[model samples]
Target: MAGAVIVHHHARYKTYPGEVTGFVFFACLIASVGGCIFGYDIGLTAGLTSTESFLILFFPDIYRQQKEQVIKNQYCKFDSQELSLFGSSLFLSAAAASLFASPMARSFGRKWTLFSAATAYILGAFLGGVSTTFPVLLTGRILLGVGVGLCIHASPLYISEMAPAQHRGMLNILFQFMITVGILSASLTNYWTGKFIGGWGWRVGLAFAAVPGSVIALGSLAIPDTPASLLLRGESEAARLTLQQIRGIGIDEVKQEFDDLVAAAEESKAVTKPWRELLFGGKYKPQLTFALAIPFFQQLTGINVIMFYAPVLFKTMGFRQDASIVSSVITGLVNVFSTFVATMTADKVGRRALFLQGGTQMIISQILVGTFIGLQFGLSGTGAISEQYAMCIVLFVCVYVAGFAWSWGPMGWLIPSEVYPLAVRSQAQSITVAVNMVFTAFIGQIFLTLLCHLRFGLFYFFGAWVLLMTLFIAVLLPETKCVPLEEVAHVWRKHWFWREFMVDTSADARGAEMRKRIALEMS
Candidate 1:
């Protein structure tokens, strides 16, 4: 929390200059295209594994399992290691790639990082389209995972830096919104392709990823790098012009905001070793904790349990193949529409409100889902439940999906991207992304195994995690709505728990220290 009283100046100027300009929207739009690639992959995996040609080509064991009519346990029918590998390989590579994405963002700038990710995505998609063997298919998936790691690490950071503090939450949520759009698009694509396109449908699904990749690659060239990124790279004039253009404000108004950015950047440059500081410095303890914890809890929310494997889960509950896919589409629709609600209310209602509201809702919905499944299926997991019971379970799953879409889904990205100082921002973001992907990959790989072993108990397992995470949010999280990125440390310093980790350095002392450090570096 050591900073100048410029926070007071920020407070006095209650009215912000930046509105959601067309330029801002366009920039956010382009940045958000990265989400489509991520979401498409998630939605595609559920249906891709279900397709007959895909199974025969790469996983015949699963195809045979699907054909068995001896009333095999509904939970264990699709439990194949090859299918788990196929579903999870992307996330493992993505987790590794996130560690590298930090330095890439810092060295090449956010815009170029996005462009590189898009290129990887396109290449991965093309490879997947042409793949004839399992190894080749997995290689393509790993490439896509690399793309996911880089894209997730950069896209939210870009949007946060580009947006005004007042509107940052909503703009960042645009990324999540685009992800839902991608999921919905993928769901629709799978439904039609699986039904009409016959044996080659999975190839078409894999190839279609190139479309969003192309959007991000071309769009990256068109948008300017963020002012914060520009300032960090020591391009003050360029940063000023970008700040002005994005803000759509008068010269003086632009200068005011630009000066804040300059001060933050100067303080940031004083830190020679950001990763060491992040790890060992007490002042950065809260950020490090938040960076790791938010994503950890977000994954624990069991949103991906639905997003990544909705069709498989539904089919296990007694729905026919086509009905399960349709059910996924329905959940995807709820995800999209619920995210739209977050986009509207996040800035206005603040982050904590949504987190608490959605967490409570998710807990209730998850418990309801668990109870319903236990009662209907019993322990043997031998027979299909009635249609009425299947519909009821789907309804509760929709509730759980809606809860996640609005809260942890977007705010997870929003909080980590905005909370860190410029010095350690990229590093912290990388940590966040890495943690998220690791857990995502973990859940994706083990989900079917859990389904087979735990059967109806899997929902309860997630429901328990949801209960714990909801308490964590209530006790630990501070409201960050409308706070500028540079001033975020102020919020930490004021919090009862996190304040212990913050040093109370005055603005003047911090400024003097920054100046001396810069002079020493220059000399």
Candidate 2:
């Protein structure tokens, strides 16, 4: 029995020390296939609603209306508002569903929670594809949102806990990369199916998500659950084996980590408090603040506007409606491709550089876009969307989204996971992710309002928000690269840079120094 060796499996991981585990990355990609569904479902909705081409292909009768009657009456019009409600329901359901994920992972464990999410995904996809009425679609979206909420919340926790310190950023950044790939895929898939698949094809588009859901389901069987999860359940040996598999270093390297986790858990008196403990109680306050704020700033940047309406934004420039969506696909391609840059650059360039560069670029891109939208040359005066001035809007948006994709998209999740102590990773991650979903829900729900009424105001507002977030992040976000996630708290809890002042006061001093440094450079 002592000589009997147990074969261990890792589900999906990003980094282990300096080495890239090909098998690990491959499995992770497969498990991450859920993200593809997440991306495809949300991104495909825009094409389903706004792309006139989708209408012509699916319901030619609706598109080819009698000029004299239906044109004048507007009865049973293509309900853009209804579409918004359906989409908003999905987001709201997701935000609400996220509340359930931590407890699920805590109670049922990560493996089963993911399996449950997969079940929800399949059911949602089925309902969406077969819906005979608008209400049915809304219901399906809500279901899909539940699956999405669970995946978004748990997947990163899985990768972060599993990836080795050396390669943690590369591995965890998969969430951002997959999301971009999901958006790109949905836009392209919608364009292709709406154009080529023809009648009822849009239904097929919704149903396609089931494919990834199934893949994640199967892939889930391939990887072991987190060591932390097993330990939380009092399976110490299983936890140690899992830690060994994930870190890929001999047990010696992570033996301390495992012990630290065990020690931390024991020292806390196993305080299994309610979620409200995290929200208002002193024990979890710093992490709670971070959890709430990371997602807030991420959404405040108006990234979803670009994600959902990039093509429409492009349409305002000179691209034909169809061409605009195609251009949107190109932007998504940039996102996916650039996310690879994160894998390469995240540990190398570090979170701070990427964020600073990305934030500065986002501000510039937004201002340029606002400038173009404000010019009113093509949008209001209507010489053409392609007027030399208006085309700049398209160019600027592309520039802005590329910046966001490479930076906040990944770092937002990365920082939240790392910035908190491991004792509260799941709970803190849940709140941050829930906050993110809420922001996404609010902004996503209001696209029609922003585009319809205020138009240019949305751009300036988001631009300003990004500028402010830049200040916040430059001040508060500690450099986490090469530091153990468990040790990350020390960066904020102790101010090595300004030892004379309290860490809080030192953080303020650092923020001011950062601002002055940026100002001088800008000047």
Candidate 3:
């Protein structure tokens, strides 16, 4: 009976001890709170900007005389450019801060990097919550953006390094899942608060972001830095100890993995490429392009349009203020649930397949949304649609959200973190994430303005980009399921069509050959 019980435990938990898995899980969970904060900030603005009390308090110029009307239309006095700036401020700040993330992560280590981020979050939330004027509130959001930039850049890098290979994809994607949860939480909070707390509710919601940031800051202290970071710092013994703790195994058991990590670190150090090499030098051009393109396409899919302006979209679809908020909540729920699907299936089904499938679905959904809205409202914007038709627009928007949640949402972070070489991993990730934030800020800044000017045609613009993104993935993205981090460069080098672009020089060819040989021997 004891033997049988032991066998069952082995079957269920695999090689790691239950305690070790639990520890790793706890660490990752705490780290993921940063993602939750990102999501909360995104969702908070969507509902807050549409709330009557928030509008009156912050933008009295826009709120005057329309207070008795439905909340969605109450801010008609504000132009598109003003609304865009309000939504884009956080992302703009994030983009600026992302440029410095690599230096911070390399110099201070991942755990402390995240701790600093949490501190920024706390300060930003406090400033935002207490602000009486627009500039002060914008300043608070800028600080929050700095925090978001650091946390988003570091969280997945830490997770990918620490997690076991078999569980890595799921664990890494968990960061994205936490983001969806934060969005849902914020949406629900805004819904309830907007209904009950009057104008002060938005302030409370914005201030509440500090709670999770505080948790992440304190929790980061308990988790050790990644093994790779320690090795990079020449702290071999400390790296080994951290690996032992994370793997829940003894020194002997972790020896092989530790050796592999050290070897990879040494190899990475041997090729000391400057940051400019990632752009101007041809050595890392493929990786640099892949890193930038994936995240850029991710934003172009128009997912943030829904994330940042769901209530506004719903109003355009002809829903009432309360109904629009409720519909937005439904989209948030779908986003959270679909991300769970991605987390469970990422490793099993592979990244490329999900991207292809999800991209196709997103394209179709966007087309349908554009068609329905255009048909109802007309190109010149002089028609009205029935409630039934408006519901169709809402349904398709939910579908697009689901498609994105499971595909680009998770893969955007996962692929970039895994594909870059260890030496340039932090720098490459920062670049990609910075590019992501740039596009996010651009979209957030212009989406409402486009809606006013383009009306139903706005969906068509995004649909076209979705179609282009699908083609881009089908052509360039390679499957990276279960590939060792050190061999990721080989996967790109081995691509059937893009091999020339990825393998530019004689040294790269030799390096790729050597990595392939090593991968075979390890297998």
Error (Å) of candidate 1 at residue 140 is 1.2
Instruction: For candidate 3, report its TM-score.
Output: 0.90
Task: Candidate 1: list runs displaced more than 4 Å.
Answer: 1-16, 68-71, 504-508, 512-523
For candidate 2, lDDT tens digit of each residue in 291-389?
A: 888899998888876777565556544467677777778778877887778878998878988898999999999888877766653234233444565
Worst 10 residues of 2 by lDDT: 1-10
lDDT of 2 at 21: 63
For candidate 2, list the clashing residue pairs, or say none: 11-223, 14-171, 318-386
If the candidates were sorted by their lDDT against the true structure, best first, what order would they fall in? 1, 3, 2
TM-scores for every candidate against the unseen true structure: 0.94, 0.84, 0.90
Better of 2 and 3 by lDDT: 3
Clashes of each: 1, 3, 0
lDDT of 1 by residue, 130-198 (tens): 999988888899999999999999999999999988899999999999999999989998998886645
Instruction: Judge candidate 1 against the unseen true structure and give its global Cα lDDT, from 0 to 1.
Output: 0.86
